[model samples]
Target: MEVKDKIVIVTGAGSGIGRATAIHFAKFGATVVVSDINTESAQKVVDEIISNKGKAIVNKCNVAKFEEVENLVNSTVNEFGKLDVIVNNAGIGPNLLRTHESRLKDWDAVIAVNQTGVFYCMKVALQQFLEQGYGNIVNIASLAGLKASPNNISYSASKFAVVGMTKSAAMEYATKNIRVNAVCPGYTESALLNQLIGAKPEMDAILKSVIPMKRYGKAEEIADAVVWLASDNTRFITGQTITLDGGTSL
Candidate 1:
């Protein structure tokens, strides 16, 4: 699935790995649709991609809202004329607290963004893919999805759900010319991690130590895996998670 010249949509393109992945797709010769909760952030990303001479559009959308997600997909197809890939990267982590002690709001927020959001994006992407007879999905599940992340029960639960959803969908559509896969990044440097680190330094330190690499993964590194998964390189790959956790899962 050479992404070059393809129409791609990436949710949470405002910052972090999503931002990097958006730019990477553009660099690979794809026309990108940048969607985010913040209009300003989404526009900012669009501008940067344009400044780099890449084709892109900014679409402000809240993935948790079905209507917004629908609009995001419709607008992309309206502008680009076709859809080829969708990267569901928008997600929120849990507050650094035990489940019983954590605010219920935090729990709900994590589930809505990290899990439900994936569902919305996938639903829309799959519709277009089935109609066109081609598509690819690279879900950004977390290292937490496959292992325990103490004090972040809500976050872990949402990611784990994403993993399950990706596999189920992949199996359902393996013969539909739509390849679905996920990437489980280990302690990637991102806004969510920074926020959690601020709230609990010791917890962050423990996470880094568990990784065999003993450091946080970079956004571009994760983006690399995402690109491969969306390209012809991984044509036979589906219903699998390429876990790059520096041996954390081992």
Candidate 2:
């Protein structure tokens, strides 16, 4: 992965997979913008990167808002001189309920953050890329996006939209040198997973049992794939979804 000196942005970078990806990008010598809704957590990740002799900055952004997303990209370019890559990783899960039983508010919230958020980021970044003539975008989707997620209608719908957007944008911008791709992770070990397991302890085992590997994925493992996709190593690959599910999607 040759990402040295690349200007990269990782949304939802305060913790979990986004945090790991930000750290990894910094370690690879990329100037990373750790963007998150949580300013404190984003600052902590920035501090950790700086302490490790890596360049990083904190940008508090709620991806749900287009204006905020615009500012995030504009500010990064204003500070860094150019935009190179953006990892659209900020997303929210929906309440555990069937489609008919789910609240409309939950669906709207999930779509706002998970689907529309990605669109805003991509739109703003693509504008910059069109001007610069090159860019990379890696969207963090989910196994639910590829397969059906029963009782998780909102999450599934949003992630599926992410996958669709990635492919569509890739095709639309291929001639412009803008590459777009997605990573679909399954049951990754993260704060989100912890919350789910906390709510239903038995889910941990049940989730693992369906996978051939019979285990969860680490945040760092998913980060590695994201970085590779963002790096020059995968320059020729676009509009693709890399599944990191420990065989759950098999």
Candidate 3:
């Protein structure tokens, strides 16, 4: 329950929510494994953690690749002897487009990272949890996964699959001491959202106008939810999706 001294792995730790979550864990005294597709970025996170007097290691990993995911898990165990929690946060948002006009390649790319990538991480973490008799997994889905987004079919569809996967995995591993859950963030302030708004500056105001809070969610706010879900306080909770969307879904 207490993340202090626990071995935690967070994918996509290079930036945004992933970076925030990694730092959050370290701040709680967890021994973190900072993994990202970019080795340089991962190392920078590692350095930051070290500078702050936290224990951490860096792993260059792309969760979309099954082999890379496997290596990430294997190396964690080899280095720390056990894994306590894993955050499946690596995902990509495709360009906005009507479903009928969407490119096959775009759809495939979104599914590969957002859907299949979560599966790969879950698969490996479940196996490790089974062996260890306990583990925690927090997946980052999206508000799009819960509600329909008119022009973003591929992104929404992939995230919807993630929400489904979270529930199914939680049911299967309930009695095994492996708790699974998802966090759906709505219009979070992150590099991913920045890129989207950069192309369509008007969306910056249009998107925020809908949220009841009248502002975008913060990465640290999402990280707080994720860390809590991973803690002992939520042990009895599983097979659930915690939506941090600033009341937009309402």
Which candidate tops TM-score?
Answer: 2
lDDT of each: 0.90, 0.95, 0.93
What TM-scores do the predictions have? 0.96, 0.99, 0.98
The full ranking of all candidates by lDDT, starting with the best, is: 2, 3, 1
For each candidate in turn, give its C-alpha RMSD to the true structure in angstroms: 1.3, 0.7, 0.9
> What lDDT is reached at residue 122 by model 1?
96
Which model, 2 or 3, shows the larger TM-score? 2
Worst 10 residues of 2 by lDDT: 91-100
Which ranges in model 3 have alpha carbons more than 4 Å from their true place? none
Q: Looking at model 2, how many pairs of residues clash?
A: 0
Model 3 poorest ten-residue lDDT run: 1-10
Per-residue error for 197 in candidate 3, Å, reads: 0.6
Candidate 1 lDDT over 34-132, as tens digits, reads 988887988888999999999998888889999999999988888878898999999877687877898888888889999999999999889988998
Local lDDT at 165 for model 1: 98
lDDT of 3 by residue, 68-144 (tens): 99999999999999999999999998688898999999999999999999999999989999999999999999999
